[model samples]
Target: MSDVKKIATRDSYGAALVELGKEHDNVVVLDADLAAATKTCVFKKTFPERHIDCGIAEQNMIVAAAGLSTMGLVPFASSFAMFAAGRAFEQVRNSVGYPHLNVKIGATHGGISVGEDGASHQCCEDFALMRSIPGMVVLCPADDVEARAAMKAAYEHEGPVYLRFGRLAIPVFHDEENFHFEIGRGEVLRKGSDVALISTGLMTAEALAAADELAQAGIHARVINLCSIKPLDEELVLKAARECGRIVTCEEHSVIGGLGEAVCAAVAEAGVACRVKRVGVNDEFGHSGPAKEVLAQFGLDAAGIVRAAKSLLG
Candidate 1:
């Protein structure tokens, strides 16, 4: 493995939008007065005509994006995860999800990693909200390369998609040239037989670090990045459960209705015999603090993951 380069997934999303703008003329972007913060400003600068600022009305922005999709335009509605997935949920569920329109919701600043933004801005329930919508593809990319690839995949996909991005700068572990990104496939970064550390979003980086720490303690860990939360890679998950006999799910979001729950549901439905443990915010809200501090406080960091893995293994 090479030295990791740190980059925010939101930045990757912005760059991907610009590249998509050049590739597809039908691609349009809509932001709810948070273009700079959500990194949609890059798209606005590159394709001024294709970008639309919808003021602070998140509901109207989502509805307008749904309308734009009806006109055969692939609309990417960009905003903070809280507002996009929480505030405009009714609009998204009714307008886009109900009609099964080709609208991509680029929700940046997802999870408690929003840091000083506090509970109001930090969205930890986006996965729950997005996953509840039928026919909606929920994707949470782990790093820059996956974020870029996910954006492209969402654009090419025909149905509604909710692409979750983060504010924190995470390690970019995947090399774009050799990385394989499929919409519903989980990638195994490490191979081990003791325990499988399945993670999503920024938590994948922590899982990798925890794997290294576990190795030193003579506990081999298999790290799997479940980028696609909805339409999850059930095959890989069950395979890991059956082979490893121990499963630990880590995510920046809540323990409920997130990656942890998804893994549990998959394993239970498949009747996979494995002990499962979750490492995430334990059914609570976020507070104002530094991102790393907040993550460590909630046991969503590497040490936390290692602890969870050890507990599960025992």
Candidate 2:
């Protein structure tokens, strides 16, 4: 609808770091030899002195970032999701999460959307891993605007934060002037009554498309962007479960401990009566292919979401 402009969330994160670097002198960036791929090169180009290249050592980068945080510097560590969240899990947990350090982890190429890189680069369990860490805040921004906002929010918030980004360029749905984003807040993009489509990251665009399709079939679907995964907006989720009898969660990550499971747990804890249908990567490894094709293959597309919603409603 918004002129179909496609921009990668990683691009937004890169631009955000440059802006933040200019505004906050204490802000520093560290990348594990993937600055270009992670898009942190933008910040490195602008503020060379403030940027550190850790050279493929994600664990060392995590430890360095934690040490920088102790010195009152806001360190944004950038890397592929597989390395940032997987290879450096122990360092992140012990050095950052344990001390509640102000280190922002910018993990790009997250989920099966990493595409041709295959399963080794694709990280579907980053959310689960990061969410398990104590005092860790996880965020999966839906689009470019949300990604920029989330980057700023991560910088402002204290303690460890994981901001997930994707390699594929997705649709931009939010207007710059009208978009309001907070650290732990969930925004409802579309209002409906029949069912609620709760989604995070790039899958939110698909959820919106699904809502449009559901409307054509006389099924009023509420579209909620659950960007904040760790400190999930439980109140909004519960409200959706109560208002809309059926709930469908869409995400690019695995359904194991991602948005899908978080939504189901919230609904259950609230004692709300609702049937939840999770549309995600069903606990499997990613394959090498086009990102869009892979998303469709894994039932993370708009049509797939519509099917899931319809199935739950039935």
Q: What is the TM-score of each candidate against the true structure?
A: 0.98, 0.98
What's the lDDT for all of these models? 0.94, 0.93
Give a tens-digit lDDT track for model 1, residues 13-81: 999999999999999999999999889999999899999999999999999999999999999999999
Among all windows of ten consecutive residues in candidate 1, which has the lowest summed lDDT?
A: 1-10
Q: What is the per-residue lDDT of model 2 for residues 1-314, given as tens digits with 9 covering 90 to 100?
A: 66899999999999999999999999999999999998989999999999999997999999999999999899999999999999999999999998899999999999999988899999999999999998899999999999998888898898899999999999998898998889779999999989999999999999999999999999999999988998999999999999998999998889998889999999998889999999988989989999888888899899999999999877
TM-score, prediction 1 = 0.98
Name the runs in model 1 displaced over 4 angstroms.
1-3
Candidate topping lDDT: 1
In terms of lDDT, the poorest run of 10 residues in model 2 is 291-300
Error of 2 at 290 (Å): 0.8
